[model samples]
Target: MGLVAINLLGGVLASLAFAFVELRPSLPFLFLTTLLVGLILGGWAATSSPLAKLYGGALTTFLILFGTGLSPLPASTPESFSTRIGFVLFALAYTLCMTALLWRAGRAAENSRMA
Candidate 1:
């Protein structure tokens, strides 16, 4: 319950900050911000979960950094094929990372409770 609320709040705040600062409305930006937020909030959730005990905080940190932080926008320019590929890869990776982290955290929390 608390994890869900924290995740939602963090995602909303990150997205709002990006939208206002960038002054542009784009799906990719929203996705990236939300994923980053999830990674952060998910890490907090992990401390109470079994996975954190097994994998430790670094795994959570890596999951956040690699999963949400490796956006390809910095690697690509606007007027090139690479830009398109970068955007696609960024979107896919962001979505996958968020999904995986959330699933892992939730499962771990449930497992810890069961144990």
Candidate 2:
């Protein structure tokens, strides 16, 4: 639980920084941020279940990040609705993929150590 909370905090903070601070989110920026955050959050196998911590932390962080991205864009019309939803989906997918890769690598390392 503590590990999950800590990972969640770090991931969410990284996501928020991109959301609020970055005026224009480029591909490299998104990849680097997510990769770094995921590496830091996942590479530490403090608990027995690194997979649970990684997935839980990542899913929750992005869900919250999704809300942050969706909040300001009040999608009233069809075009805006699609745009907002698409943006949210695309960003979430891209970030999650990168994060998941790093997290999985960490989990594998933890497993190897246990064996």
lDDT of 2 by residue, 1-115 (tens): 4544444454455456555435555667656666665565455434567465655466456545543443445553334434544555566666678788989999999999999
For model 1, the superposed segments whose C-alpha errors exceed 4 Å read: 1-80
The per-residue C-alpha lDDT of model 2 at residue 110 equals 100
TM-score of each model, paired residue for residue: 0.29, 0.35
Superposed model 2: Cα runs more than 4 Å off = 1-11, 19-24, 45-60, 63-115
Report the number of backbone clashes for model 1: 0
Instruction: Report model 2's TM-score to 2 decimal places.
Output: 0.35
lDDT of each: 0.49, 0.55
Task: Give the clashing pairs for model 2.
Answer: none
TM-score of 1: 0.29
